[model samples]
Target: MYRSHTCGELRISHIGNTVTLAGWVQTVRKFGSITFVDLRDRYGITQLLFGEELNKQLDENPLGREFVVQATGKVNERSSKNANIPTGDIELLVESFSILNKSAVPPFTIQDDTDGGDDLRMKYRFLDLRRNAVKKNLELRYAVNRSARNYLHENNFMDIETPFLIKSTPEGARDFVVPSRMNPGQFYALPQSPQTFKQLLMVSGYDRYYQIVKCFRDEDLRADRQPEFTQIDCEMCFVEQEDILNMFEGLIKRIFKDVKGIDYTEAVERMTWEEAMWQYGNDKPDIRFGMKLCNLKFPAHTFPAKESLSSLIAGDFAVFNDAETVIAIAVPGCAEYTRKQTDELTEWVKRPQIGMKGLVFIKCNADGTYKSSVDKFYSEEKLKAIADAAGAKAGDLVLILAGTEERTRKATSELRLEMGKRLGLRKADEFKLLWVLDFPLFEFALEDQDGGGAGRWVARHHPFTSPKPAHIETMINNSPKVADLDKYLEHPYAGIKANAYDMVLNGNEIGGGSIRIFQRELQEKMFAALGMDAEEQQHKFGFLLGAFEYGAPPHGGIAFGFDRLCSILGGSESIRDFIAFPKNNSGRDVMLDAPSEIAEKQFDELSIKLNLK
Candidate 1:
C-alpha cells in the first residue's frame, strides 16, 4: 500500500506506530543537519522530520515544494506542536522515502497567501485548489449540496435529470446555441433553467421534482453573473405560493444548520415588491442594516400611496423641482463630514455608472442645527424640514439624488448599497433572509421595440408566470397598447401584479419563482401581452401551451442560484471562488483554453461557415 494512514490522520495517540504516508510536499525547512517538511493531501497536512542521516539522502535527491513523495516512518509526538492543524500533535519520523513523481515548479505558490494574480491562479487552478483556503470553500459547497439533497429527498422531492440541449426560445438573456452536424443549418440551445421541462413534469403528474442542474445564457458577465451556472431547480404541482414559501424556507434553514451551524430559528421576513422599492429603493433589500430610502418627490403612478413633499423644492431649486424624482437616505453619524468628504460623495454620484448631475446634502449638526448644499435656495427652516422628512437625527447626514424617475431610483439604490458597504453594514457573515413578493407582471420594454417609436410590454419574469388572481381579468381584458409614450404607465396592464416571489439574502436575489399559468386561455393571453403573435408563440412554446390544456394542476417552483448561495454561505463575495475550474470574467477557461475555433473539416461537416463582422 502507498500509505497506511492519511497525512492528516496520525496523532499523539499513534506515537511509536510505524506507518506509511504519501502526499505532495507543502513546504520544506532546514535546521542545521535536521530537515522538516509539511506533507499535504486533500485531507490535511502533517509535519515530517528528517534526521541527520536522511539529510544526506535529501541532499543527493533534494525535495522541492509540491513534489509527490511516499514515506514510511514511525509516528512520533511533535517536539513543537502546531495548534492550528489537526495532526499538529504528532510527526512522522522518516526511516525511508521515495519520490512518487517529480513536478516542474508551479507558476504560483500553492499557498493560501500565494503571490499570484487571478489569471495566473486560474491558469494553475489545479495547483490553487490545493491551498487550504480554496479547499475549505469547496468543502463548504459540498456540505451545502449534501444538506440540500438530504432535505429535498426527505420532503419527497425526486432528483430528476433534464436535457442540456433543447430548442432555442430566447426570452430574458441570449441563448448559447450549438450547431447540429446531422441536421445541417439547425442548432440546439442549451437549457437556461429547464423551465419548460419542469412545468411539463408538473403536468405529467410528477408532484415534486428537483435537480441540481447546469444552465447557460449568453449574457454580459458581472461579479455575480456567469455565462454558465448551476441552479437548485425545483417544481411542485397542486401547491400554492404559501406551500412553496414554507417548503423552501425549510430547505434554506436546514442548509444553514447543517452547513453553517446556524439554527436560524427566527422566521424569514416578507415584503411586497412595492414596499421593498419604497423603503429600500431595491426589491432585494439587505435588512441587516437600516438605511431605507426616503422618497421626497416621486411620480404619482410609481407609488400611489406615497405622498410627496413637493414643498421642499417649492423654492424653485430647479435641480430638485424639475427632476421627475427626488430621493434621499440618512447616513448615521456623518453630520461632521468636511466639505472634502461631502464633495467626494458628490463626485461618487456623478460618475458615469451613477449618472447623476449633482448631489444635495443636509447635515443635521450635533447641536440640532442643519447645514445644506442648497442653503442658497432654502432657508434654515426649509432645510430642517427636509432633514426631518428624511428621518435625519442629530449628527446625521442626509444624501439626496434627483433625476429621471428610473435613473434616479436606480442611482439612489446603488448609493444606498455603497454607503452600506462603506459603513460595513453589508456583512457577508450576517445573513438576513427576506421574500420580496408581488412584482409587476409586465415591465415596459420600449427599447426592445424594432422601430424605436414606442416600447412594448414584456414579461417581468416570463410569459409562463400567472397573474395575481384579482388581476387575471385585468390582463386578459385590456390590450397591451401604449397609445402615447408618456402615458405608458396609465395602461391597464401596467399595474397588474404577478403571483411571483424572490428570496433575497443580504441584498442579493438568491432565488425566484412564480405560480405558473395553468390555463391555456390565460397562458395565451400572457403570450399575446408579450407581443408574441400566434405563429411565433406556436413556434417557440406550442408544446408548453398544449400541455397546459391537458389538465395541468396548479403548480409553482423556485430555482436558487446554487453558486451564489454557496458563496454567501462561505462568506465570500465572488462566486468564482466557490466554483472549481470556473471561467474568467470574460467567460474564458484559461486552463482548458475553451471556446476556441474548430477545424475547417468539422465546420464543413456541419455545413457552416464563419462570417466575422
Candidate 2:
C-alpha cells in the first residue's frame, strides 16, 4: 500500500505508531538541520518533520510544492503544537521517503485567496479546485444534492431521466441546436427543461416524477447565468397549485436544514404579483429589510384595484407631472447625505443602464424639517405630505425616480436593492423565502410577426400554463386582438391571471411552476393566443395537444435552478464557483478550448455550410 493512513489522520493519540502516508507537498520550511513540510490531500493537511539525517536526503532530492510523495514515519507528538489544524499536535518523523510524481510550478498558488486573476485560475481550474475554499463549495453542492434526493425519495418521487435532444419549439430564450449527420438539413435542439416530457409522464400515469437534470439555453451570460445549468425538476399529477407549493416548499426548507443546519421553521411569506409590484416594484422582493416602494403616481390599469397615492406628489413640478409614473423609497438614516453624495446618486440614476433623466430626493431631518430638490415647486406642507406618503421617518432619505411606468418602476426596484446592499441589509447568512402568485397569464410583447402594427400577446409563463378558473371564461370569450394600440392594458385578456407561482429567496427567483392546461380546447386556445395557427401548433406541439385528449389529469410542477441554489447556499454570487469545469462568461471552456470549429469533412457529412455574416 502507498499509505497506511491519510496525511491528515495521524494525531496525538497515534503517537509512537509507525505509519505510511502519501500526499502532495503543501509547503516546506527549514530550521538549521531540521526541515518541516506540510502534506495535503482531499481531507486535510498534516505536518511532517525531517530530522538532521533525513534533511540530508531532502537536500539531495528536494521535494517542491505540489510534489506528490510517499513517506513512512513514526507519529510523534509535536514539541510545539499548532492549535489550528486537526493533526497539529502530532508530526510524522520521517524515516524514509520517495517522490511519487513531480509537478511543474502551478500558474497560481493554490491558496484560499490566490494571487491569480480569473482567466488564469479558470485555465488552471484543476489546480484551483485543490484550494480549501473551492473544495468547500463543491462539498456543499454534493450535500445539497444528497439532501434533495433524500427528501424527494422519502416523498415517493421517482428519479426519471429524460432525453437531452428534443424538437426545437421556441418558448422564451433561443435554443442551442445540434446538427444531425443521420438526417441532412435537420437538427435537434437541447431540452431547455423537461416540460413536455414531464407532462406526458403525468398523462401516462406516473404521478410523481423528478430529475436532477441539465438544461440548456442559448442566452446572454452574466454573473448568475450559465448556458448549460442544472435544475431540481419535478412534476406531479392530480394536484392543484396548493399541492405543488407545499411539496417544493418542503424541498427547499429541507435543503436548508440538511445542508446549512438552518431550521427555517417559520411559515414562508406570500404575496400576489400585483401586490409585489405595488409594494416592492418587483416580483422577487428581498424581505430581509423593509424599504418598500411607494407608488406616488402610477397607471390604474397596471395595478387595477391598488390604491393610488398620486395626489401626494400632485404639484407644479413638470418632472412629476409629465411622468407616466412616480415612485420612491425611503432609505433609513441617510438624511445627513452631503450635496456631493446626493449628486453622485443623481449621476448613478442617469447611467445608461438606469436611463433616468435625473433623481429627486427629500431629506427628512431629525429635527422634523423636510428639505427637497423640488421644494421650489412645493411648499413645506406639500413636501411633508409627499414624505408621509412615502412612509419616511425622521432621519430618512427619500429617493424618487420618474419616467415611463415600466422604466420608473424597474429603476426604483434597482435603487432599492442597491441601497439595501449599501446599507448591509442583504446579508448572505440570512435567508428569507416568499411565494409570489397570480401573475398575468399573458404578456403583450412587440413582435411584428404577422405584420401587426403594434405587438402580440405571448404566454407569460409558457403555452402549457392554465389560466385561472375565473379568468378562463373571459379568455375563451374575447379575441386577443387589440382595438387600440395605446390602450392594450384595457383589454380583458390583460386582466386574466395564471394559476402560477414563483418562489423567491432573498430577491432571487429560485423556482417557479404552474398548473398545466390539460383539456384540448383550452390548450388550443392558449396556442392561438400566442399567435400559433392550427398548422403551426400541430407542427411544434401536436404531440402534447394530442396527449391532452387522452384523459390527462390535472398536473403541476416546479424546477429549481440547482446551480443557483448551490451558489446561494455557499454564499456566492457566481454559480461557476460551485460548478466544476464551468465555462467562462462567454460560454467558452478555457481549459479544453471548446466551442471551436469542427473539421470540414464533419461539416460536409452533416451537409451544413458556415455562412458567417
lDDT of all the models against the reference?
A: 0.90, 0.91
Per-residue error (Å), model 1, residue 341? 1.3
Clashing residue pairs, backbone N/CA/C < 3 A, model 2: none
User: Which residue segments of model 1 deviate by more than 4 Å?
Assistant: 449-454
Q: Residue 92 of candidate 2: its Cα lDDT? A: 92
What number of clashing residue pairs does each candidate have, in the order they appear?
Answer: 1, 0
Model 1, 498-584: lDDT tens digits are: 999999999889999999999999988888877778999899999998898889999999999999999999888899999998988
Model 2 misplaced regions, further than 4 Å: 447-454
How high a TM-score does candidate 1 get?
Answer: 0.97
Per-model TM values vs. the true structure: 0.97, 0.97
